[model samples]
Target: MKSGVLKKSGTNKKKAIECLQDTTKNTIVFKIKSNYFNENYIPSSNTRATTNFANLARGENRQENLRNTIQMINNRFNSLAKWDNPNDDRYSVELEIISVEIDIDGSGTTFPSIEVLKTHINDHKTGKRIEGIVGNNFSSYVRDYDFSVLLSEHNKGKENYSIPDNFGELHGNIFKCFVKSEAYKKNFTKAPVICLSVSSNKIYNRTGNHHPVLGFEYLSSKSSLTEEYFEKMGLKVRYFIPPNSVAPFAFYFSGDLLADYTNLELISTISTMETFQKIYRPEIYNANAVAGQCYNPSLKNQDHSLTKISYDREERTGLGIEQGKFAEQHFITPNKNFLEQWSANFTM
Candidate 1:
């Protein structure tokens, strides 16, 4: 089915335009109130701890921690030394953060909402905003997730049990709201991208003997309903786990941005089996891990292959953290086949 905003009323157009104008100014980072992360809230015993920067919300320094994490992502992507696309003259990619707040009522219902709060362009050596589209505005949600059973189930295991039935519909509504706004049509007529960093403990690799492949859950399940819906709107989706990142992030984009190979290059450069092993359970990414095992979503009987690469000791040992860890990491080293496959699979 199709996704994104479908209705275009005069009032909606006016509001969207206003939102776009308000966000496009010189503002870089927008900070939310501290109360947004309530200390009183606690997760149930059954719920597993969230990975990556998502865990920052539980601590007292939620804002600072998340900001630091985002800054790292920004710095890594903007580094020209790390990304040199031989296909294009552009040597760098710039990204911005657009923080949005979504409110969940006491009954655990997520109010379909988003607000563009901050935008940060990466630091480039040229000291000028690199031409062309400067990547996406990192949109983040500003509410806790303990109360929602749907979120808990989808987020806290070796495999996602199920996604919210309306997950795709909500994203569709949000996309509609975003596109209707003036900023989207005027500046991002090509369609903007949304990058989300969240937990992926439940996503496992079926072919690697059930070894946890990063972001596998989102791609293989009904949880991908939102992504499928977005694809119908001519957008593309990609997911990856950064080195030492407990959770993986999803990127949705359109136009030339979708064709750009920078995101995957950066991710592969920074990530290693050891890093993933440390963040997730070691048993998953370890060298001795077996192959052919798979994870079956309780709701769906089908099985999804985790990775084409075997996770045997030889393969696992070959992936050393030091290989790609350098300030001036290798450029022109992205996996082209992987990129093409991902783009084809997610783009309708």
Candidate 2:
């Protein structure tokens, strides 16, 4: 059994390397910018910050928001997602920004736009890029998660619960443009995973459940509408609330990539989520109130002007309840079955 596991690992490693090589060949590599502003972290003054969907919206400071969020995510992975091997090594994922050429007729649409950015694994630490780490990308809007409109449509009833017709078309085009890119051809022997993070409070179905469920279940159901469109194009979908995360993130891939995750990898992912919660979003973890502080962009001497923001528990749906519930349901509760079968594989 040990030898068989080793052989399977070897095979997976080979496939991963091939995928990485293909990715490198196709991807438009840009040097990682040293500063936040250069990396599109700061938003322009004209950008509008609104509160219609504070939990769901990406806000006017979209780049800054992403910078802060990704920073927390990266830090979480680095700090908590470690492997207790001979070297006591740590694992991390790298995110790269890539632009896809697509024509948008911005006549008078108030909807958010989608951007193509890919997530890659750092090969040196992970050993193989494709096995534990795969090419995952996300489609996000320029200004918001577009939940205000989405929720309104969802309230129209189950028939309209799926992504809006126009929104679906836009995403379809984005995927079409992505597949045509040289990067897509080189990096992916199969379809890359697509992740979506959005607000879930109002979008969820609150009735007819044997047990209480988070709004994510409803949101995932809605996303299934889009998933079907993608599946017809040859992709598979998996949606989850990242452990300790308030926002909804959906992952789409070509095959059973998520199913192949080891128990340790899942634990590491959850550890990252918990770490993120402890720092950026403490309310969910039932921890001390933590606030995020940053230099005010408006000030010329930005370093001197610090702006602190606290996440309000009242404003969010789950607060301290959902994350732990998710962790219990997905990880701890299922561990009994996992342990019964793969007890020896839990070395990490």
lDDT (CA) per prediction: 0.32, 0.34
Looking at model 2, residue 175 earns an lDDT score of 49
Best by lDDT: 2
The TM-score between candidate 1 and the true structure equals 0.37
Single out the weakest 10-residue window by summed lDDT for candidate 1: 28-37
TM-scores across all candidates? 0.37, 0.40
Can you list the residue pairs that collide in candidate 1? 5-176, 16-181, 16-182, 17-182, 157-202, 158-202, 206-294, 209-293
Candidate 2, residue 219: Cα displacement in angstroms equals 12
- Over 1-348, each residue of candidate 1 has an lDDT whose tens digit, in order, gives 111111222232112222321222211111111111122323221111232222333455555544443444344443323444333332333222122222211122122133321222332444655323322322212111211333454567646465555344333443444454544444442345544432233353332111122322224343554456566434676554433343334556665532453444333223322232322233333223232223222212123223211223443223222221210122102322432333233311
Deviation in angstroms for 236 in model 1?
3.7
- Residue 99 of model 1: what lDDT? 26
Query: Residue 141 in candidate 1 has what lDDT?
Result: 21
